[model samples]
Target: MTSAPSVLVVLPSLVAGFLACLGLIVAIGAQNAFVLRQGIRREHVAAVVVLCTAGDLVLVTAGIAGLGPLVASRPAALTAARWFGAAFLAYLAVAAVRRARRPERLDPAGTASGTERASRRAVVLTCLALTFLNPHVYLDTVVLLGSLAHQQAAAWAFGAGAVLASTAWFTALGFGATRLAPLFARPRAWQVLDLAVAAVMAALAVTLVVA
Candidate 1:
């Protein structure tokens, strides 16, 4: 059998990429807030996790393939992305505020009965919009993570490591946050969470608009 990949050859780059990506991801923002909310509600957890991770992988690949310079040079494209992101965030803010005012019942069967169950397609589309529409996500995961990783290893290997990191991080976040589901069983708790989500989305929207 061929020799196993050497830690010396792989570990440093992988660790670096993981840390870089994690640093970018752990910031309290629209995406993280939305994911945390979904996790707490235990709604379409797998689909949301997979879609988010996959979106990051695609963006990271684009950056590794030298798309960063192109993205940087296109001011109009970035501007449009920012505006679209702001609009999406605004929509989320409104939804969250409404939920905060009138909290949803947590009875799983009841929730499932009302055509309120989150579909996989909806989860995927939401994640794709959140990840791709925000120029910040592209700049962080694609340009920053890609550039940093590529500096430490070959383009393909760096991309591979970054993608792996995204998958691992999002999977852990989606499942790990589920442990807090019990806390959200109370409508009051959900209202609080919804208010927090609304604040985060609005804050991000303001930042996007200003930037």
Candidate 2:
């Protein structure tokens, strides 16, 4: 049984973890953009959200398990991830640019043609690549967050808070994106979105190569 005093002692750690994770993930990044696009398209939203949240959970757990330092020490591993991530981002940027050049209006019924709707396996794989291939994911979730978790009064509590934050964020981003469906009904809107995605992906790729 836990005492009230003990709960109080760990409250700060929990809050700190939650805020830290929320701060890190709230930014618009490749993963978030992908999820938002899927949500708007109403394709495989549940799977994408689940996979992303689970990925964060696994990475956060690994960090709490003290794998951060070990991973940080492996420069070769980071280099491999960086290059692969950069290549993937570059490819995605090109794809987005093409889409922007030839925009497609979204169906109001949320029912895209067979060609437009990507397979679940493909979406899952892409989500995995976006989550795992980026060295920044490891650096932010594993190395940086892990170090911060250890600084808390209760490390596991901090980890739990982090996981909760991840779950909440993905849930909101994936499910709440439907509200924008009306906006995406216009082909021009989609073009704008694809262009934005292209720019973001390209910038990330460049940063990875230079860093």
Candidate 3:
């Protein structure tokens, strides 16, 4: 039922959507911080990428399907989310600082069998919480991306492109960070990384609480 020109109209929107999502995603956030650490350690990188990508997909879809306005109207929900997110970020900040003070090699094979499974479980849960609890994530993917997609003639296609961008970015971030493992080989590098992460996380936490 769609004409050729009608289909072509979606291409620009698709590109725009991709760029828009990328601009928002490629930032220093809790989700990204965890992914980078996991990537460097090579611990469940694939799973983490999948979880983050799938989450973005679902959130973006919900936003485009008109969940943005409803989310916007719920100030109490956002407030709760803000508090939870801030608390989590604060915890991450402390963890990072501790890691910085006493840097350890992020050996994938170092963790014991029992501890590995438990740690992985904790990582997965943390990833989920980081992705879901952050109100900013919803605002970016759901509110901004959703709003942008609604303007496109090919809304679905545009949404697909945004989701694709999210997937590609996370995949690159999660996998590409490992390439820098050689640089992070030194404990000092990890200390610097964790310290920076801590600073960023703490600042974000404070910002969320006050804002």
Cα lDDT tens digits, model 2, 62-85, are: 999999999999999999999999
Worst 10 residues of 2 by lDDT: 108-117
* Least accurate 10 contiguous residues by lDDT in model 1: 106-115
Model 1 steric clash pairs: none
Candidate number that wins on TM-score, 2 or 3:
2
**What's the lDDT of the predicted structure labeled candidate 2?**
0.92
The TM-score between candidate 1 and the true structure equals 0.90
What are the per-residue Cα lDDT tens digits for candidate 3 across 107-152?
5565633223227678789889999999998888898889989898
Q: How far is candidate 2 from the true structure (C-alpha RMSD, Å)?
A: 1.9
Better of 2 and 3 by lDDT: 2
Displacement of residue 114 (Cα, Å) in model 1 is 8.1
TM values, all candidates = 0.90, 0.95, 0.92
Can you give the lDDT of residue 34 in candidate 1? 72
Q: Per-residue lDDT tens digits of candidate 1, residues 95-181?
A: 889878877656544443422666777777787788889989878877787678668844566667767777887788888887876
What CA RMSD would you report for each candidate? 2.8, 1.9, 2.4
**Which has the better TM-score: candidate 1, or candidate 3?**
3
Model 3 clash pairs? none
Instruction: List candidate 1 stretches off by more than 4 Å.
Output: 1-7, 110-115
